[model samples]
Target: MSGIRAVADGLVDELKRSLPQQRKTQRGNLALLVATMLEVRSANLMDLAASLPREADRTDMRYQWIARTLSNTLIDPDAVMAPFAAEVLERAAADPDGIVLILDQSKLSDRHQVLMLAVRHGERALPLAWRVEATAGAIGFATQKELLGVVAPWVPAGAAVCLMGDRFYGTADLIALCQRRGWDYRLRLKGTLTVRDSSGRTTTAARAKSKDFYLEDVELTARRAKTNIGIIHDPGHAQPWIIAMSDNPGYGTTLAYSERWGIEPMFSDFKSRGFGIDNTQLRYPDRLARLILVMALALYSAVSTGHWDEVHHPTPAEKNI
Candidate 1:
């Protein structure tokens, strides 16, 4: 574990070096906090403290300090998050396929909901930004747009960006936002949406024929607005998809939608798969939200290490569990 601790410490130092001048005071505590998360592989403060290096301080006072750092309002989530998000986007931009951004939400508990915007990298969707909504049901349209706002600017100029989400994220405002920003989007519309066809005729998605169709300047009767969109239905599946965009879409729309499932593995890693976030007793929305930043940094560290191993040690990597 000494090697792991040493590496985590180096990573923590790198994180502090990227922080804004005003946040310098948090360097020591933040480094210790993040290093512990890497070692414990859990978001629970108690678990992290118990797993700290044996030579380091491990008193109850230390545990209390860890709790304070997580719950403190002075610790800016954006400052903790922006550098990591930028790093992920910069890597994605280097790829000719550009980057894929996924928008989704999951429940942490009965009352706590986590809204996340992540960048898809192979099997995992690395979180770029997130918000914790206290409401019990789906988040509102305004909140969904706000989450996108946080992630959109991170994308580099001329980098092809693809934004994807499920039916819950298919609101008119979101589609319009994507259009205004000139980014390609593939969203799943609800089966009940009434959309106009290329021939200026309207039909519900549930009743629409199972074929690929493109329409320009079409009206969505349910939303009462006109937009260009593509509709595709897999003959083998029962549900058809209404893809809203400003340009022509083809079979690629279905392919892009399939990638949206990548986020499912990410959520699992945060809970049952890796960190025990689902088992945490933290209930206050603000505290839980702060804790998510810690989790994000830890996740980034794990992914970065995995990528390095995959590149340098191909033989061992091939023997997958």
Candidate 2:
């Protein structure tokens, strides 16, 4: 068998173990597509069809097959991703520091945006849940809430989770949701938001200056959502880090906001660096979301393979010099 077919066979076996209820044809198609993606490292239909290990004589036939798979509404992205996401969350929950979840949004094309929730792994993140919308602006809090609601039950019971997000996600509604879910968070707030401390001192977050300052039990914005504020303005940065936390604010707690950068690299992997998903001609949001699912599964498989390889065959840099 060719290397691509070999990898596809392995993925088929793995998917079968995880998704026993999935139809055999669906599972095989998904596995083949994922393996083809890993090999081609692109989302271009022609490129993928050209390398597909299918019996179809014409490349166009194979391309149509891939399109049909993506267009099939029956293939639910959430259901397909559930087992993989559970494994990621289980591993993250095992860590003493507990699970760190990152939330962010990125532009997929001229008209599509993807709001993603990912679990931190090493220096990057693995996709947990996401919603792709056909919009030019932000995917609002309603969709954000819906995405979180879907993933909330999948988290291991009693596992500590710290949710992190950039300024776009630092809304009162999101804060309330995090509070309700009992997840610790370090969401960065916009400098313009109203902040009233316990002493009833009112000011904008932009006014917070000095090396580091912590405001305990503060009410944020017109909605007056209660939270703790951690402000950090280190040298050379253009803007201060105005972070909202569920616990007492401190330097370490405020600095935890840096972990949100993990999602940036993951986005790059999905776009330019690895899969080149943005270059694809997929315009329909549903089909685009299914395409992302293919990329997500391919990424999980690649990361898992690399981890196994590193442990069994250490690189020179990992070995004692």
Candidate 3:
């Protein structure tokens, strides 16, 4: 796979700057670890060693001793990526299209845990941030905060950004946070929540029209569920925001938000593919943070290299990177 190598090279280039020199692992070798992991899924250090290609495998490249060096080194992948996050986000600022972050949690029932994952929401979704915990409900306000902390520094000044979230972020506080951060957020609320409309009518899409702008505590009707919208402008927030948007503006903005399912398959690709990187082996708080960095690179490699479709029902023995 030329595609796989290209993705790994991209990661290597990114990681080359920040990996610590004291760890006795070379920057190139660290990058090779990621590439090697993705290419050979086996967790056994020995198998990985066997898979590292030698000079004989290719001409100009003489003696690429990836296996033995990797076998001996203490690999702290997180240490390798942390120094580069801010730069990565800064570069992301230049992305012609602002980055789309999909905030969601996936289940690892065998361990009875949930990991909050913020994946890049594009044709090939890749993770840019994450948080793993023992609770499924851990993906609430705290999780959103965690995702922002890691990526916020990287975004350049005035860089426009969008966040896609499910009903879990429907609460007023999370919406307010997005406003303060100058991030455009698309969040879903249950059809039944009430909000004070601009006209101060206790109306809902079930009863109001575009001529109206604000409402409070309204019932969700099948008709209102489509174009129904509301706004909240508390002075406490950094900025006021329109409550909802929809593709079927005819009905309302619900359909607009409903369309964010674009990232669903990307999530599925991770949990169900050769990216067996589904669990967090570290329990220390900061250590876990570093692990997220490692995973971001891994996910980017998967999408850029087109490995998501190479296997179904993935296991550690399948491949890694």
Candidate 4:
């Protein structure tokens, strides 16, 4: 058998084990598509169809089959991703430093934006959940809350989770969501946001001096959500890092905002670097979201395989040096 077929067969068994409720035909089709994507490393339907191991003689027939799978409303991305996400959270919960979840958005095309939530693993991150919208602007807090709500139950009870996000996500609503879920956060604040300190003195976050500083017990903006603010203005950067955290503010706590960068590499993998998903011509938001689900499954499979290999069969350099 071809290597792609071999991989697909293995994936079929794994998917059956994880998603037993799914129809066998659905699971088999998904496995073949994911295996083909790993081999072609592209999201162009034609490229994927060309590599897909199917009984159909015509490439167009294969392409239509792939499209039908993506367009199937019965296939829920959340249900497909839950098993993989559960394992990721389980491992993270075992760590002493706890799980780091990063929230961000990226443009998929002229018509679509993907709001993604990812879990930090090693130097990169793995997809946790995502929502695709047909808008150029932010996906908004309602959608953000919905996405977080989906992943909240998958987290192990009492697991330490610190969510990190850029300025777009640093809002009173998101902080309130984190507080309600009993998760920690390191969300960056916009410099123009109104902040009132413990002394009742009101000022903008940008009013702080060009040096590292911490503000405790500050009420942020008109909503007056209580949080600790951490500011770090290094020598060359144009803007300082104004981070809000649930913990006591300090240099180290503020600098933990850097962990949010882990999501960037995962975005690249979905775009030009790995799958070239941005090249896809699919315009329907739901179909594109399903395609992202395929990519997410492929990524989780690759990462899990690599980790297993590293543990059972390390390289000579890894074994020695």
Model 3, 97: alpha-carbon shift in Å? 4.7
Instruction: At residue 180, give the lDDT of candidate 4.
Output: 88
Off by over 4 Å in 4: 210-212, 316-321
Tens digit per residue, CA lDDT, model 2, 193-311: 98776556556454575343788778899999999988888889888888999988889988988988898899999998878888888889999999999999998998899989988
Candidate order (lDDT):
4, 2, 1, 3
* Model 1, span 102-190: residue lDDT tens: 99989998889998889998867888888887878998878878878877777787888888889887767787788778787778777
Worst 10 residues of 4 by lDDT: 203-212
Candidate 2: worst-modelled 10 consecutive residues by lDDT: 203-212
Give model 4's TM-score versus the native structure: 0.97
Name the best candidate (by lDDT). Answer: 4
Q: Alpha carbon lDDT of residue 291, candidate 3? A: 33
Name the weakest run of 10 consecutive residues (lDDT summed) in model 1: 204-213
Winning candidate number (TM-score)? 4
Task: For candidate 3, give the lDDT of residue 59.
Answer: 29
Better of 2 and 3 by TM-score: 2
What lDDT does model 1 reach? 0.75
Q: Estimate each model's TM-score.
A: 0.87, 0.95, 0.59, 0.97
Candidate 4 Cα deviation (angstroms), residue 211: 4.5
- Name the runs in model 3 displaced over 4 angstroms: 1-14, 18-32, 41-97, 112-121, 198-259, 277-293, 302-321
lDDT of 2: 0.89
Q: For residues 103-213, could you state the per-residue lDDT of candidate 4 as single tens digits? A: 999999988999999999988999999999999998899999999999998999989999999999999999988988888999998888888864565554554663427
